[model samples]
Target chain A: MKLRVKYSGQLRTATRCGEEDVGWSPDRTLAELIAHLAERHAAGRPHLLSDSGAIRPSLLIAINDAAVMANEANATRLRDGDVVWLLPPIAGG
Target chain B: MEDTGQRSELDAAERNRYEWQLWVPDFGEAGQRRLKEATVLVSRIGGVGGTAALQLAAAGIGKLILAHGGELRLNDLNRQLLMTTDWIGKPRVESARRRLRELNPHVEIETIEANIDEGNAADLIGRADLVVSAAPLFAERLAMNRAAVQLGKPLVDCAMYDLEGRLTTVLPGRTPCLACLYPEPPPHWKREFPVFSAVSSTVGSLAAMEAIKVLAGFGEPLASRLLVFDLRNPCFETLPLRRRPDCPVCGPISRPAP
Candidate 1:
């Protein structure tokens, strides 16, 4: 269950890699994936989390192409083949 | 059917002009007619807004009002489709008005050369049925949101940050207003961030499509959700958005007026 993860805009600069293929997991949540990626890749720890360890409002998390509540980052369950995308503030028209 | 001569010929011309849309059954006579009679305001001729304006013009929107200011620069060409090297240092709105007219003579191009501020937002937006908030910054988007709420007009707000774009439809109190989603304008540094034309155009086209849907009364409106497009990986996402009861712009309005 490999997942294709993508980062866009300035978030790319922070993540270091625009694209990543992550090992598959069953019932993994978005937060777990980001944490895993931070450790696997040379990417710096996600600044998406605020000092309080909450997802920052300035960024957005989407599974397969839909936005999800940040507080539910880890709550939004992911399936074996799901694709989750993370993007930090750049512009939204 | 004796008078069918002129009517039949007109239908052929119309079909030829709108052949692409005509293929969509729902967008037949009524939709095409509505599009022909609709007026949309693209508040800025910047990256996303400019591209949206161009699509509107090419798609045969009956009337388009482009509001923008300042002289063009070489840098603006990256996403500002409305200008060319030949028109550098010239006024944006004026040049865009001419180019759009060339694309489709039928599109009535109007221009408001001044910037949209709290002072003139109402008057600027009052002329159109719907507003497209593609302004360069959040302050402009916020001002347009207020004007739309006051008029009960729908606003297609698009913003770009690098290769990512976020689009939200604001119907006053129906969904979250710009202020509800963003309490403040995120500071002027938001502009300091780099933007690519590819991302700008992506957001711009989506904004135009939303405006078309609203004008013609077809399809589902992104009323209570935000559409996020990340060109870096080509992912599209929509998140349900709730109206902020305390939103400064439309929080306490008697009704959304949408």
Candidate 2:
């Protein structure tokens, strides 16, 4: 399956992947896709996941314009031509 | 001061003050009066909230409660337009009040030289017809969310970092609250982040518009939707937000006592 990933806020600079097209195997969870991306980009690994390999709480993942809750990301499956948004929370007022 | 709920008819001067906006279709003297009768609370008068408050005042909001602590610094000049150089060492709320009052003296302005917290969030939010949560900390945002939900007041959440900004409007039980989006503060979120004045102010102005629309029933607001703008990519996305059934703040409240 092919997916388009976009990073927002500091994640764009940290990941150096403003928007990219990636190929993934079928039936992979959103977490797996994140882990895959983290492995490929050394700079983005720490920003995308914690030491325990859990998705960072501050990062918001939206699949096709629907935000997936942190607790549900591990179980949410991805599909072909899906657009994933990696959004880090912007805390500044 | 509390809203006395007594609204006098719009005088000729008041009508002239909002002449341009009054011409907006479906938003005539009635909409202007609604603005004059509404009270809004803006948290942390920084880049985002300062712009939001300024727009609210310019639109003739009846009352504004500005909450923020600490003195302004020279570094805040880039985006915090409400702060003047002379007021650099003064409390942020004071600068915000000065600028906002100068824009529209008819709008009642109240200042709180303290940040929003669990202790005072309820009281501050309860007094307003709506809230604009532009605080830099999720702790403050969540506090405002809880208070706004409990009080059943509308809240406009605005945030910015780097060249990116996002805004969402919360309508208590009808829409998702801040807590519904992030059940807990993102562990990676820090107090300081990169931000441009343009981005923050852009989001701030949009937030003010959302609040005005909600308060005056002028247009369709972004209820239950998050609008994210990435100035770097120059892209804008509006994602639908869902209310969590298990949302601790807004969920399980059932209905307000009739």
Candidate 3:
């Protein structure tokens, strides 16, 4: 399965690319996809996961423009061609 | 029918001053009248808040309560439009008040030298019919959100980083509040983030428009939707927002009839 992932705000800066298509195992959870991307993009690893390898609570994950709560992100299963967006909370005035 | 007495009457001078906007189809004299009677609280008069306050005053909002604690620094000029070089050491909110008053003398301007906190958030938000949350910290933004939810007032939140900007409106019980989106402060968020003047003002201008729409009771507001934009890529996307049934801040409040 291939999933399209888009980055916004600081995540875009860290990833050095606005979006990319990542090939992943079918029926894999979103958490696995995030870990794969975090490993591939070394600069975005810190922003994507904490020291304990858990996804950061502040990272907003959305599938097709619908918000997924931080806690539920790990359990969210992905399908082929799903579009995921990762955005970090930005508060600069 | 709206309570004309509470909305107040627009005098000839006021009508003439806002003649162009008054020509809007649904927002004719009625909308202008509502603007003349509404009081808005804007937290932090830096890049986003100051710009939002300026547009609100220009739109003839009856009163503005600005709260920003800090003296102007040389670094603030890049996006803090309300500050002048001469007033570097002076309080920032005063400069915001002065500039806003200069834009529209008819609109009342009030300044508070301190930013919103848990202790004072309720008091500041209670006095205004609507709120604009533009503080740079999640702590302050969440405080204002809690107060707005508790007081049953509308809030427009403006934020930006680098070339990206975001805006959302909270209609208390009817829509998702700030806490619904961010249940807790982001651990990695720092006080200093990259801010381009253009991006900040863009979000601020949209925030002011959202406030005006909510106040005037015309046009569609950004309730339950988050508008995110990236100027570098020149892309704008609206993400659907859902209220968390367990959201501590707004979950218990009963939704009012539309």
For each candidate, what's the DockQ? 0.24, 0.68, 0.76
TM-score of chain A of each: 0.76, 0.91, 0.93
Off by over 4 Å in 1: A1-9, A15-89, B1-12, B254-258
Q: How many backbone clashes does candidate 1 have?
A: 15
- CA lDDT of B117 in candidate 1? 86
What C-alpha lDDT does candidate 1 achieve relative to the native structure? 0.74
Provide the clashing-pair count of each candidate structure.
Answer: 15, 1, 0
Ranking by lDDT: 3, 2, 1
Q: Of the candidates shown, which would achieve the greatest TM-score relative to the real structure?
A: 3
- In the range A59-78, model 3's lDDT, one tens digit per residue, is 87899887887688668998
lDDT of 1 by residue, B1-258 (tens): 022233223256666887887677666666766777778988888888889999888777778988887889988887788888899988999889988888878788889887788998998788888899987666777788888888888899888886678887887656777776665553323555567888888889989989888877778888878887767667786776755566677887765345
Order the candidate numbers by TM-score, best to worst.
3, 2, 1
RMSD of 2: 2.7
Q: Arrange candidates by DockQ, highest first: which order?
A: 3, 2, 1
TM-score of predicted chain B versus true chain B for each candidate: 0.91, 0.95, 0.97
Question: Which one wins on DockQ?
Answer: 3
* Superior by DockQ: candidate 1 or candidate 3: 3
lDDT tens digits, residues B1-258, model 2? 232344736888888988999999987878788888889999988999999999999999999999999999999998899999998888988888888888898999999999999999999998999999999999999999999999989999999888888999998888888887877677667788887888889999999999989988879999888899888868888988877788889897564354
Scored against the true structure, residue B85 in model 3 reaches a CA lDDT of 93
Predictions: Cα RMSD each: 5.8, 2.7, 1.8
